[model samples]
Target: MSQIDVATKSPIRQRTQGLRSRIEAFVRTFEWTWTSAVLFSMALLFFLLISAVVMPSFWMYYAEQKIGWAGPTDLQAFLEKPFGTSITNPLSLEGYKQVRDAIAMGLTTG
Candidate 1:
């Protein structure tokens, strides 16, 4: 080939070589920093989000199974059940007084 032909091809060859070098560098950097804990935490968070989003559906299904009924239902009965109270936060003195007043009002009115 002529010198001009060689010169014309040189820039394309250099660009392809540069691109390959950059890709290899990126792969090396990623491989060096990748960790199992990071991957595990990402997967765990994904499942947690999925579970949180699906929990209401599961709760409704269970309520239907227990009652032999289907379709939308009141959540209050599920909230007021004995196991419901187990999830309650322990009250501070001020919080206890507030809850007491609320309960007292609820009881007196209905």
Candidate 2:
């Protein structure tokens, strides 16, 4: 008999093996049809539309509200400090203040 024993496997390996088996069993139940492909594509398209377009629009709206601007210049200001600028430019209300504070305090070990 082989020296390797199933029960001797590490907990993580055992758990992963169990999860892989479960995933395989679940996937085997699915019928891969053209309809499924179209459905998946539509779902992916919807997700992309929402994340790429709708979400940024919402963020811009919220940032405009925070910055208290409602003019043509609002677009310029938002473009200057988009949602992913930095820690301080989070909403671009004041700008740089929060970044200064975060820098003053060292990052947590955890």
Candidate 3:
């Protein structure tokens, strides 16, 4: 009696006794359908989050490894194209500036 009285300082704990009997209480009020739905929703949200956030980086890595991987010749060509002899090449005329540029170059657009 003395130990029990010492344990509880608040009147709120004195009323409930913490409802320590979990087995009988859960058996009376458990809803399986609602619990299953909550679990399924959590699983779906986890799947969506992983696919959306984590999968693109994996796809990009695989794509770069598959198609966009550049050879030494390819990179060397890119760097060497801008470093060649001073060939006075004009812009090509498949653009909106084709006529005006042809006129500037003293070339016929026809």
TM-score of structure candidate 2: 0.48
Per-residue C-alpha lDDT of model 2 across residues 6-95, encoded as one tens digit per residue: 667877887798799999998989787999999999999998777666665664555456745333334455566756457754555333
Per-residue lDDT, model 3, residue 38, is 95
Give me candidate 3's TM-score against the actual structure.
0.30
Candidate 3: give the clashing pairs. none
For all candidates, what are the clash counts? 0, 0, 0
Which of the numbered candidates is closest to the native, going by highest lDDT?
2
In order of appearance, the predictions have TM-scores of 0.28, 0.48, 0.30
Mark the 10 consecutive residues where model 1 has the least summed lDDT.
78-87
Model 1 RMSD to the real structure?
A: 19.5
Residues 1-110, model 3: lDDT tens digits: 68778586566656555564665688788777988889989999898776665565454444345644222223344444533233553322122133333333342211
Please write out the lDDT profile of model 1 over residues 1-68, one tens digit for every residue: 68887787867785798799999998787643358668878999887765655554554455456633
Better of 2 and 3 by TM-score: 2
